[model samples]
Target: MTAPEKPRSPLARLFMGADHTLDRLLAYWFATCAFYMASLAVLVAEILAGTTPPQAGLILIGAGMAGVTSFYLLVRFSQRLGLEYWQLALYQAVWAMGCIIAAYAITGPIRGASMSLMLVVMVFCTFALRPRQAVALAATAVVCIGVTMWCMARLDPAQYPPAVELMNFILIALGMTGVTALSGAMNRLRARLKDQKAELQKALERIQTLATIDELTALANRRHAHAVLSAEEERIDGAPGPVCVALLDLDHFKLVNDRYGHACGDAVLRAFADAARPEVRNRDLFARWGGEEFLLMLPDTRLEDAHRVVARMKERVASVEVDGVPPALRITFSAGVVQRKAGEPLSDAITRADQAMYTAKSTGRDRVIAA
Candidate 1:
């Protein structure tokens, strides 16, 4: 899309970028902001109810909100640095974990509920991180939870019982493990689907080549030539310049096949195409019309220019040296060039070119004749 046309809406403007990558990063960043706000609300309730120390609670909440703002700015900066979404996302995930640990340390009996928050973090990671990354984060969470619970219980036995903390750790570990496994399975499935898509695209390209090209000469085939001719004919009325059609035939193809072998004849045919291909312009098409004949469609060309093109190709093909062909066997072609007129049918133009080619053959073995 053009630059001006991209994302002018107020909602899209808030993200500050029209790029799809930046949009996704901002999406996650916005989600992070919402999560932090909701978490602060819960912590505030605890502070009001006397379950958490108000002074410590306010400090933690302020720091958490500040961190959310900091991450948003960093995420925007990462867009300019060309960093990937996952890099910042992984870092934000770690920061969230830190906030959870801080909140757990300052709360009373409700400290056990931090395991649920940790579970939410693990599940959120599966959407962004790869399998290995998700597993690493899960492992880190396990260690942090264990250490925090051990310290809290030793400091206050009545508040955080050792048996209760142990059960919470086990449940947290099991939940994170399950989410990581699911992430791994999803990553594997995505890879398999990507491979299948590439293979299918290659197969379609091969099929298109076979449909439009001659395998032997690597030139457009008879069917493709017809299509191009029809299009040129249809555009003749308003075409910027004249369109020319030419038919060419090998001078002594059958004699070469009879004397040397079909192999040498095939070699000569391929050599002629290699010699003639360079003479063709971007607006022209060279096609194998039949067994020993070829057709050329030249757009924005006059009869004389088209004839000169074929004449140059004839000289090149005459000097070509094929691997199996004898030095005495010089390959050449006789062609008929004609400029198509307005309102003329494609078939009639081709018939005229074919007749001119036969006339060239009748007058001499190798020459270009324009009609």
Candidate 2:
């Protein structure tokens, strides 16, 4: 038999799953440092071939080591120091400039790879820095490369003629400027997309809330209550417990609406909902079934227990006083409680509960009945 494959460790998975901006920044830093070190090795080889002085080669190696060390330390400690994006970008720009200047000083700006290094620095800055900062860094790179080449040509005419050095510097400057503009445009587009995504998420949340909640009483609507009922019925099918449902209707609601205006009736309805909400457990679903009627679902509850809960809620509702209504005015609700049979459909249970509620209304206005 083939050996079973071992699962990957959590630490390995964590490293693989890390794709945040900080991870990208660290990857870029490491890649750039590696390229610089490779270039430094090449420069040393050129020195041994008598193309560069030994003293300049030594300086280049030392500068390359220092640059790598600085980048490593900054990346490792940046989180603890709470460095922000712009701060990291500024530090990186400064570090790149320092490395470029040091290399130019050692290898003569026009004859060595200093112009190419400056182009790499500009590209990385365009990616890492903000728009205005990237533009500023590009301009600084242009000026630095131009000044270095000019000074080198003026000091050594044989190695770097003025015309050729100026032309090369202009080409490098143009390239850096183009990269900066493109990166800025990309950054702006990315920012706009992020904002739009956040707005879309909030819109979706609002839509979900409106779909599930009743507008007047701020309770779950009939549709959501039915869904909860169905879920509870399914859960209790194989379990050794009961799921109970109660249908409640306000007593003499039509009379109240006729005596007082619809505004006062709405206030009474809202007050009843507020009073009854605290009586039910958190896991129970109390939703507005329709005008002046509500449904409550209790999971893992017995019929007698549900009857007692409804009795308490009925007493609470009778004591509730709507604002602007007279103290003499009273409110009461009649409830019908039913324990769902095992494997019974939720619609059948609701119908039975509705019948019981009507029976309670005919027998007496303010009482609880179980079916």
Candidate 3:
């Protein structure tokens, strides 16, 4: 036999990733805003400096425009190419690189390079993408930083702080990258655990539903009714009140099955169950007692009240229509109802109800006989 299928892993389930076009668009808008804000800050700072240069200001503004426009295009590409989270992360890394380079050009290397500390972007990505994708992002960030440093070292030696300071800069970047990677890993673990719990809960509920339900008529099955009656019996601690039990059976059910196909008979049984469900009180328990028969347990109810409920249910059953059947397709049920006698076993109450039901069936088809 083939093994049962297991659920897919959380990472595998995130196949769409940033392909959710709306999400990608929103992310791009936020990144664009960040770029604009960063550029504005640098522009104002350069204005404050006594040695403000016209070329530097234009470069800062140009970089901000490019970052925003590039992001807009990337968002459209993500939609067209159906990019996943990993691909989006790679794109974000490239965007970060451009921002860092722009900052370096406007300011010098040491002052501008600090902007690459946008490793904080990973925190947002951790919650946005899966762990594997986040890891991909950390790798990309490292590459971007290395490339930016190499280019700056060759083009502008005066911008480099000192050898020791450069070493410190690399160490700080690595440290921040480590923090982002660790946090992303923890978040993914939590997400996976939550998914597993939800799956388990649904599976357990299905099992319990199957155990209590009658397969034929979709009514509560016999085992459940017996368990409920036993529990109700235990609740009675020599109290003044008595429990009421009712047994119901379809009259001439065998004859109906003989006249119509078993499928039609099954339909009739289902109709009967549906009719009975509404008549039962919230506190009452109803179940199929096997083959055209049913049991009802009414806690703390008198025999008279039970009889009234049963009468209403029987009337409803008789009124039900069996589709595609003959006009004379009227059906009836017989019921036996009894209240618990002091010092009597729960089974005795059931037995009394059973006898009363048969008495109604023998006397006539459609009626309740209370004991």
Candidate 4:
């Protein structure tokens, strides 16, 4: 019996990697910088109030320096933990927790320091945790804060006069935690939408390329070539400008496949395409017609000029080398070039070009025939 199908890994769901990783790192750095700024403000206030400034200043400075260093480290090393997404998520969570601990040590509730810990809950919800994880983390924050308040009460019972303050603190923490969870859900939704948008754009680009490109020769295929010719024909009529169409047929291509394998014949076609591609203008359209034939639309070119272009293309094709072939192995093409006549259909011009190409083939194997 077949084994049960394995689940798709988390990495499979994450399609955007290169840019997404950098974006996460940048978000971490910005959040870290904001944490440092808030911490700095607290430390400065302590100093101005004549609290022993040196110790607090030293500790705050150390924390800031460590944060800056960790920012660079996270940026560089996060990707090395590939497929270990939990590790990255944990890093973000733990980093935020460290800031909470730092804030509490220096100035607990006296300066509303413990209140800042709410930021940690918010960060967990925003960057690292899913709904369940966020709820668990929020519960953890509440428990920790309760324990601290209980300890503070036990240490100096008179200082903690009323339970009202404790209630307010708990309520504020819950409120912040809820806000963070809600915002995190929204952020996750946005991220998923962005990922979907990127995927759709990639699929559309692939479809566009497939629509225009020839499967065998990798040139523009017949459908695209015909469309381009028709468009150019219209342009010529509207502007009263010259446009040329050239039909190229391989000289004795059947003999090549008969002598060599079909693989070798395909190689010759690809080679011819590669050689011809650079010879045509960037604005010119090139396509593979049916077997052993090609069509080119040269906008703003006269028939004489188009003939010269195809002649050079033939020379390039003849120069290509096929390894493991006989010393006398060579390839050539016959081309029919025609100009768009005034007030005429583009298909007629293409037909005329085909006739001229056949005339060239009948007269000689490798020459251009212009009509």
Candidate 5:
């Protein structure tokens, strides 16, 4: 064993929840804040280039407003209204591309420097969008760049020379394609990792199931039975009535294995389990304790009622005939029933039940004895 989980207070929801509004905003902020930092760095670059950083005070404020407002709109409307990831990525990309282009137009002679912001935005979209959607966003950036350069060339031919604008267009095209290739590679790696994670989770569940279940009878194994008893012991006083335990043993099981061979013996045990399963209630637990024996635990059930349950099991099992075994073969079980004593370890109760089971065996096999 492990200890039970501690109860959590109501206020823990603020930070504990992953889907709660405040927690989601805070989680999103970690990624969103990086854009804010990048925008500040862009302002610094403009100042270093000896160009007037237009709206320098407003840059940080604008970055904050854009990041937060987009998230708010995405969560409250776009996401809530059930838009897809590609739609959300495209939604953010459109407005973001507009911001980057506007920044480039304002920077005058050092307009080429703003291409880095375009790279950052597209790469960020790569994580949230499909390959086709990312390509669409990149293509949109390419079109915006071409139009901005062509118009700037016409309006201010001195500041934006035709030769320089043509060269910038070539460089921007290459950068966008490089971003497309990067997104394709990332999507492949992420898909591979997701598949491996799913396989690992399935393997873990299979192992856990094997550990608790008996392979032969498909019943809870002794380890799981012990664990259940320990759990019930923790709340013995809180229960409505005493907890009853019954231990059952097949009479002369060794003779069946010896005379009919192990194959037939295995069949007999499986048949007995099938017969006994339906006799136990949903709230009660019946498990294969070990070789030639089974255990039952009934919480909040009296010893008399528990005895009746086992007697019922005994009656059902008496008529069971295993397939491929001798047709004359009859399966039967001897049982011992005991109610747990106050504050006593359940292990002790199981021992008493075992003693009573042996008493039933000695008296006449296929009978029930209460202890």
Candidate 6:
């Protein structure tokens, strides 16, 4: 009996579950909630120590709770409300800016802790917003902080020294703008790389399809057919049933080309493929072996069963008509079918089928010979 598999790591499962955009947004919301809780604890401690005014602490707590509640509602109903990621980012940015302004008013412009938080918000915007939007947000933040500092220094000189206020404003504005510019450049570089990667993937896929598929008949090409035969031969080793390989050649194909030109010959080939494809079973493999020749591999089928399938295909081929050809003109194919013997190589089976096909051609123009 097989042993029971070990469970996946909890951390791995968590990350896998968080792969969606909504899940990541929820994660960010939870992190922000924790940060607010910690900040509230610190504010309460400062109030108890008489370092911060009770009224100021109360205001900060109220604002923090309001931000938390807004984020919670947004997270819970974002999908129902059809809120896009960019819209959510814009709302967060606006809320953050408002919170910073309120904190600056209570804590003093030059030495407010909220000034540092504003820098964090600016950096975050660089990642969430487009380059132009990020730059606009940075500029708006700088102007707002500058205006707030100027007003504070003029209306309350004791609390906000003009020299200190000016220095803080310059430092914070420069920092926010620098980060925004760098992040925008990085985002553009990343987008270019992503497009290049996608184009490279498409190129590789086209190359693979060209290599394996016949351009004219849309069937598996000679190389792909041989690989399939080899794989089937290996797979059926010591198995319960027979594997049949049939080689089919359009009888007197040159007569069509000589009579109607190569263009009509191509049409006949394509029409034969269209007629024959419906006769092939899903489990069987069919491919264009070469010019006017095709190959079929039928797993778990006997030589006689393979003969019947090819006979049906021949009937279908005869009924197929090409443009510019007379109604009296009929198309037919001679096929050779051989069941692979135990431990026999695929090459030997294919050679025997080819010889049988030649025999069928020599004996009668359109017939199936089993070897």
Which is the leading candidate under TM-score? 1
Give the TM-score of each candidate: 0.85, 0.77, 0.57, 0.58, 0.83, 0.75
lDDT of 1 by residue, 1-371 (tens): 66554545776666555555566677877887888889899999999999999999999998998899888878877857776777777888898888888888888889878667877787777767888898898899789888998998899879888998888788877887887788788878888898999999999999989999999999999998888877777677666468789999999899889988998888888999999999998778899999999999888888888888999998898999988778887898889889887767767888999999999999987999999
Deviation of model 6 at 46, angstroms: 7.1
The reply for model 3, stretches above 4 Å from the true place, is: 1-161, 238-240
TM-score leaderboard ranking? 1, 5, 2, 6, 4, 3
The local lDDT score (0 to 100) that residue 288 gets in candidate 6 is 96
Location of the lowest summed lDDT over 10 successive residues in candidate 4: 12-21
Model 6 TM-score on a 0 to 1 scale? 0.75
- Model 1 ranges with Cα > 4 A deviation: 1-14, 18-21, 35-57, 227-240
| Candidate 5 residue spans exceeding 4 A from truth | 1-22, 29-70, 77-79, 84-86, 237-241, 281-283
lDDT preference between candidates 1 and 2, better one: 1
How many pairs in model 3 have backbone atoms within 3 A of each other, for residues 3 or more apart or on separate chains, i.e. clashes? 0
Candidate with more favorable, higher TM-score: 3 or 6:
6
lDDT of 5 by residue, 1-371 (tens): 98765544565543343234444434544556567566756666676676745575356447656665665556445445777656656666776677678767767877788787788878877778878778877887899899998998899899889999999999998999998889978988898999999999999989998999898998999998888877777667566368888999998899999987899889888988989999788777789998999999998888988888888888898887787766676788899999988777888889999999999999998899999
Error of 5 at 369 (Å): 1.5
Can you write out model 3's per-residue Cα lDDT over 1-371, one digit (the tens) per residue?
98764555666335324234355455656765685677567666765673335677666667667767676555555656677655665566566656654555446434544454565566656655777767666666666666666666666666654563367457746765786767677786878898999999999988898898898777778888788877777777556477899899988889878988788889889888887799887788888998999999888788888889899998888888886457587778889999988867789989999999889988976889998
In terms of lDDT, the poorest run of 10 residues in model 6 is: 12-21
Candidate 3, residue 71: how far the Cα is off, in Å: 35
Higher-ranked by TM-score: 1 or 3: 1
Model 1 RMSD in Å is 3.2
RMSD of 4: 12.9
Off by over 4 Å in 2: 1-73, 101-128, 233-240, 323-326
TM-score-superior candidate, 3 or 4: 4
**Which pairs clash in model 3?**
none
So what's the TM-score on candidate 3?
A: 0.57
